[model samples]
Each structure stands twice: as C-alpha cells, then as structure tokens.
Target chain A: MPYVTVKMLPGRTVEQKRALIEKVTDAVSETTNAPKENITVFIEEMDATHYGQAGVMHADKK
Target chain B: MPYVTVKMLPGRTVEQKRALIEKVTDAVSETTNAPKENITVFIEEMDATHYGQAGVMHADKK
Candidate 1:
C-alpha cells in the first residue's frame, strides 16, 4: 500500500483538486500495480513562507 | 537527503509548527545520521474531510 502526497502552493480550486486526486490515483495504480481503491492521495498546500530553496525562502523571492 | 512529512489535523499555532519542524528534523538527523541542514521537513495540515479511516471519512465520525 503506497500513499501518494502532492505538495504544492495554495490556490487551486476544489475542482482542480478533485481532478488531481483522480489522476494521481490512476498514475500510481498503473505504475505500482496497486488497486485504485487501495490508493490514498494527500494534498499538501504550503504558504510561500513555509518553503525555501537554496537557503532562501520562497516568500523572499522577487 | 532525507525528506520528512508530518500530516495532521489543522489547529497548531505557528510556534508549535516551528517546534515540530525543529524536533522532527533533529529526530531524522539523529536516526539517519543526516546533517540537520540536509534534512527537509514538511508540515501538512489537512481538513478532516480529506482524511478517512476504515472506509469512513473522519468528518463523518461522531
């Protein structure tokens, strides 16, 4: 049982999230041969301040 | 390069989140022997509606 997590910036609409859940489930199921019903998808949305790159916070980027 | 994710209900304040990140990073570092700076921790707060257990959504539970 493999759980999938999609981490991204906030602001996606509910419909987009719904689609994302469906599609990612399909992909993971196809790739891993796991049953679709057994797959779980978690969407993790983070604010800019919570993410950083190369020692700089995303919120600080221009 | 080890990445850690903590998924839980949404309620903790920023101070708690800060401490969580710090402590989890330390734990991962100590166990994996990875440097503190090389460890990345992501805190994912999800609504109860998004989580389910034993074929039931958490929001539906009494």
Candidate 2:
C-alpha cells in the first residue's frame, strides 16, 4: 500500500479536494501500479503561523 | 530522521495536539534512534465528507 500525504496551505473548496484526490490517485496508480483502493491519500493543511520556509514562518512574511 | 504523520478526524484541541506531537516524537526517536530536531511530525485532520471507510463516506454514516 502506498500512502501519500499532501501538505499545503488551507482554503481549498470541496470540489478542488475531490478532484485532487481522484487525480492524485490516478497518477500514483499509473506510475506505481498500486490499486486505487490500496493507495491512501491524506491532505494536511497548515496555517501560516505553523508553516515555515527558510527559517521564517509564513505568518511573519510581509 | 523519520517523518511521521498522524491522520485522524478533526476536532482535537491544541493541548492534545501538543501532547500528541511530543509523545509521538519520543516514540519514533526511541525506535528509530533519530534526533528530535531532525524528526518532522505532521497532523492531518479530515472531515466526514472527505474521509471514507469500508466503501462508505464517513459523512454518510448515521
């Protein structure tokens, strides 16, 4: 089983998420040939305060 | 270093999350021998509509 986690900013609509899961499942299945049912995708959303880049928190950006 | 993520339904308080992160980090470190700072832990929450089990969406359950 292949477990994939997509971490990004919050605020996507349900439609976007639905499409994302489907497309991502397809992509991973195509590349790895893992069964759709066997592959699990988890979406993680992080607010600016919790996410950091280059030692700077996203919330601290101007 | 090990990258671990805990995926579950939403509604956990910040204190619970803080404890979860700490304990999970310690467990991973003890088993894998990875340093604390080098380990990255992500908490992903899913709504009923977005999560499914046994071919049924969590939202569809009674």
| Pairs in steric clash, model 2 | none
Clashing pairs in 1: none
Flag regions of model 1 displaced more than 4 Å. A1-45, A48-62
Weakest lDDT window of 10 consecutive positions for candidate 2 chain B: B51-60
Which candidate achieves the best lDDT against the true structure?
Answer: 1
Error of 1 at B56 (Å): 1.5
Taking the tens digit of each residue's C-alpha lDDT, what string does model 2 give over A1-62?
67776777888886676667678778888898887778766666789899888999999995
lDDT of 1 by residue, B1-62 (tens): 67776779888876566667677777777887888778766666789999999999999995
Q: What is the lDDT of residue A36 in candidate 1?
A: 96
Candidate 1 lDDT over residue span A1-62, tens digit each = 67988889898999999999999999999999999999999997897655543333445565
How big is the positional error of residue A1 in model 2, measured in Å on the Cα after superposition? 1.2
Report interface Cα RMSD per prediction. 4.2, 3.8
What is the per-residue lDDT of model 2 for residues B2-60, given as tens digits with 9 covering 90 to 100? 99978798889999999999999999989888999989899977876565432334455
Sort candidate 1 into its docking category.
incorrect
